[model samples]
Target: MSRGFLPRQHGAWAMLLIPFLFGMFAAKPVWQHALLFLGWLLAYLFVYAFLQWVRTGQIRLYGRPLLLYGALLMPTGAALLWLEPGLWPLVPLFIPLFLVNCYYARRNRERSLLNDLAAVVQFSLIVFAAYELGGGSDWRLAAALFAFSVLYFTGSVFYVKTMIREKHNVKYYWVSVGYHLALLALAAICYPPGLLLPLAVLLVRAIWSPRAKLTVKQSGMLEIAYSLLITCSVLLVYAV
Candidate 1:
C-alpha cells in the first residue's frame, strides 16, 4: 500500500482508537461493534483524505486517496447503518463538527486551537457511538467517558503546541500548564479519586515535558503512554 493510503497524523490514531475502545469495553461487546469500528475507521480515513485534498488543492497528489477511501467508506458506512439504524441520530451530531473541520482545512488553519477542539469533540463523541453499539445503558458513564476524552485531548492540543509550533511562545506554555492545573483542580473537587492519578500525571507532563526539551518522537511516545494510562484508569473506575 502507498503511504498516502494511510493517515500521516500519528497522534490522531490515539484519538481515534482510545475513545472507541473505551466505550466498547465499558459495555458488553457484540458482533455489531466490530462492524461499527470498521466503518468508523474507514470514515476517518476518508475524512482525512478529503481534508488533505481540501488543504493542498492538489488533485494529482491527494485524488487517489480521496477516491479510494471514500469508495471504501461508502459501503462500510451503509452496511453499518443498515444493520444498526439506531446510529442514525449520531449523524446530525457528526455533520456540524465535520463541517467545522472542513472549514478550517479550507482556510489552512487546521492547527488553530478552535479547529483542534472541533476535532477533539468529534473524536470524543465516538465514545457514545461505541457505547450505544455495545449495548451500554449507563448514560452517566457514557457522558463521563466523553467528557474525559475531550478534556484530555484538548489539553493535548495545548501541550503539543507548546512542544512544537509554539515552542518559543511562553504564553502558550503557561496556557497549557494553566489548563492542566484547572483540570487537576476540577478532578479534586468533583471527580473520583481514581481520576486524580491520571489528571496529576497530565499536569506533571504539561509542566515538565516542554522544559525537558523532548523531541517530537519522544513527546508522541509520552502521549501514547498517557493515553494508555487514562484508558486503563477509566476502565477501572467505570467499567469494572
Candidate 2:
C-alpha cells in the first residue's frame, strides 16, 4: 500500500517556510497566527495541486482527492479572516497576481523570469500577512520585510538560472555575479550593518559556487546552509 502526500515543490517550499519563519520571528507569535500559518500552508498545497492539474490535465496526477482536499481546506483558511477581519480588505489585492500566475501556467511559462518575480511577490505577501497577523501595525516594518524577501528571492532566481537553465551561458553567469555584488553594496548602504553578513555570503556564493562545478545536490545543500545563515542573521539583528 502507498500513502498519499501533498504536492512537494521543493524550492517553493523553502521560500514559503523561510519567509514565514522570518515574519514570525520579527513579531510575537500567537496561537492565532500559528493556526493561520497552518491554514495558509494547506491553502498553498491546494493551489499547487490546482495549478498542476491545469498544467497537466491528467486526472490521475491530481484528481478527486486533491479537489476534496482543496475544498475541505477552504474553511480552515477562512479561520484566518475570522481572526482578523481587517485582512478582508487584502483579499482583492491578490486577484491580479493570481490571474498572472494562471496566465503563466496556461502558457507553460511558469518558470519565466516574470513568473518568478510574481512568485517572489506572492511569497513576500505571506511575510507581510504574517506581520499583520502578529498585530504589527508599522507600515515601514511590513514594507521592509516585503522588500527583503523580494530581494533575496530575486537573487535566488538568478542563482538557479546560472546553475541549471543558463549553466553554460557566460552572460547570465556574469549577470548573476554582478547582481549579487550590487545586492551586497545596496545592503551595506541602505540597511543595517548586520545585513552585510548574509549579503556577503550570497556575494561569495554567486562569484565562486558556479565556478566550482558542484553537483546539483551539492549546490542545493550549500543553498540550504546559506539560507540558514541568512535567517539566523536576521534573527540576531532583530534580537539585539
lDDT of 1 by residue, 189-209 (tens): 867899898989999999999
Compared with the true structure, the alpha-carbon lDDT of candidate 1 equals 0.89
- Looking at candidate 1, the ten consecutive residues that score lowest on lDDT are 1-10
Model 1 residue pairs with clashes: none
Specify the poorest-scoring 10-residue window by lDDT in model 2: 1-10
Candidate 2 runs further than 4 Å off: 1-5
Q: What's the TM-score of each model vs. the native?
A: 0.96, 0.93
Q: After aligning candidate 1 to the native by TM-score, how far in Å is the CA of 175 from where it should be?
A: 0.8
Give one digit per residue, the lDDT tens place, for model 2 in 1-240: 112337555688878887887677687788877777777777677677677677777668677657776777888767778868877876776678777888888788888888888877887777767777777777687677678888998998999899888999999999999999999988887778998988988988988888899999999899889888888887787634
Error of 1 at 65 (Å): 1.4
- Candidate 2 lands at a TM-score of 0.93
